[model samples]
Target: MADSGSEEIAVIGNTDLTPSESENNLKNTMVEKGTNLLKRMEINVAEAEKRTGKNAVNMQETYTVYLIETRPVDAASEGTNPVPDSLWRRYSEFELLRNYLLVAYPFVVVPPLPEKRAEFVWHKLTADNMDPDFVERRRVGLENFLLRVASHQVLSNDKIFYSFLTEENGWKETVFETGFQAKADSRLKALNATFRVKNPDKRFAEMKHYGDELQSVISQLLRVRARAADRLYGVYKVHGNYGRVFSEWSAIEKEMGDGLQSAGHHMDAYAASVDDILEEEEHYADQLKEYLFYADAVRAVCRKHELTQFELEMAAQDLTSKKQQREELATGTVRTFSLKGMTSKLFGQETPEQREAKLKMLETQIEEGEELVKERNTECDEYVKSAWVDIERFKEQKDHDLREALISYAIMQISMCKKGIQVWNNAKECFSKM
Candidate 1:
């Protein structure tokens, strides 16, 4: 049971899951999925073009697509090791991957992907406006995203992962599911397996499950927060370009300054206000990351407890076997055993006295082993209890903090939006007067 003071800290159905560490080697056992992906595969955005349907009359009906080139660097199979192969994928395809990662690994902060703009008018206008420079920029962003996913611990090892990097016939034309429905079942299965304790036990199962849930929720929240930061950067970057475009137009800043001196400053101020909101959002994201850290701590402790129990069980079995062997030796049952059992005697016969001495020593060793296991188990249990106390306290504080932060962020974003509308209105008024 967790500490009473922090009893309110519950993951599922108000059950308090404590944060503790038992297996020091548990972390070492974690396979870095992302690293393995990077070592085995490389991704590059190759030839990009607009794909059209059977009808050639309407060229504008075509949508932009890119050839995703996958290079297998070091595969063991004869046919697997090869030159780079490629496949055509639309922006929507990449979008699916982003959504899949966000939905699946709720703990991971999926990188910001390029925004979609499939509008007819926008596409028409940007036909010539969308230069190779801009296309390359977006491609780089997409490539960076794949690299990030490749390095991610959970995302890298997913079954659907191969479909992403491989140009295998079926997957080459694979259509991705959209929204939360995309990869939901597979993600849940992965999450269940990912959170499972190696040494299974009932008491620790719920704790591990709840811990995983908390980690996932917290991670998703952080991903949202980071996305806000990404949005801010996007806004900030465009705002700079806006200023540049304004500078190159109609004596720009000076002409605009003639009408309202504060107009330019007001736009900057509004951006600043939005940026502040984004900053706050990013901070909340960071705070959620801390919660994930605590959740992981709980899992480590739970695993340690499980491993200790396993050790205890094995030791008990060993003790039982040793005692049985001692009884058999004392009763001369060894002499009546089969050929294999007496194979050692063929090499060197053991006298009755020698056999008795060996049995006594074996019994002493098993007794000592049992005692050691018992002591270790007691120590592990104590640690588990202690960890639960800390987790409960931590849950009370972090959960409260997270709630407060969410409220604060909502208020800030709302306030900023209102301020932005006012500033834009002011700018419009100032410009009309000019």
Candidate 2:
């Protein structure tokens, strides 16, 4: 269970999926390799501690905070490594930093933070926020999240993130002073009020669809894994009963007593092994959850692209309308029906001076609209190019991570099965001796 008073925070969700040949070809022009700042700077969340704090209502409460440690790998002029810096921050602070990253780099697929509350968890893994196991898992997760962001070519460069790491005091103040949340709110309102894209990019559409599929598949996998783990736990625990029954029967037997006792001991050991197996399995499940959360980051990039496209279209439409107005002013003809045309017909033709003034106003407005349209077009192009580059990078990382996770999980399961077989085999030997 998460803390009862855990703050309800909003995070960016949306991810892009798939890569087309065209995008692959453009990768060379997008971002250069070896640009990640973390290539020189190392970041880690090494520890978690429970602390007492005042809640919103002023009552004393306990909360968990993590210690973030950062150090530069690059040697100084004297050839010595930089001294490490550490900061203690609560989980909400991580959320704040991630939220800012999402807003600041809308085109980039921001790496996801670990879950604040456990879902689809195994029966053996306690979801309690203060549980030693849960806290340890979250600590590793937070560290992974930082490493991901620090390794990003763009996100690693954020001054706010640097401040979050080094400037322990007033970091929250710095984040709020950026006014990013207000800007995000305004952007949300605009998106809500805007019309759907008239000409959505085929690639983005495909990516968005793929993101949806990825999330659904991962969610289902996690759910199934949790259920399977629970069943496995029950099976192992139930075998402990067999150990009890056999051990009691051993005392009542004559010649078979020794063999029965040995078999009972094997059963007891087999039953006890599940506690460690399931714990190990939870690590793999957490890996799966990371990608499941990653799906949202993918879609976020796609959503930003849509917004860029939408703005571009709106600007182009405005420019076109302005150009049409200029043409009507020059030629005294209305190609499209409008209120202005009706008003002009009702009031009759204006004086030459009035016409000249209107022409001048239209000309100025048309010039500005054309400029706006050009800027918007450039923005859209740049957003698409940059977005595709990050998406490609993310795809490679995702493939590698998922493959390793799945492979490790399979190996663990195989080891577990072999152990079970060995226990049974030994029990069989004991029976043969009898």
Q: For residues 117-171, could you state the per-residue lDDT of candidate 1 as single tens digits? A: 3111111124341455446545655675676556544345554555766644554
lDDT of each: 0.55, 0.79
What lDDT is reached at residue 87 by model 2?
A: 88
Q: Residue by residue across 224-264, what tens digits does model 2's lDDT show?
A: 99999999999998889889988999999999999999999
lDDT, model 1, position 272: 53
Global CA lDDT of candidate 1, please? 0.55
Clashes of 2: 9
What C-alpha lDDT does candidate 2 achieve relative to the native structure? 0.79
Alpha-carbon runs more than 4 Å astray in model 2:
1-35, 74-83
- Number of the top TM-score candidate: 2
What is residue 20's positional error in candidate 2, in angstroms? Answer: 35
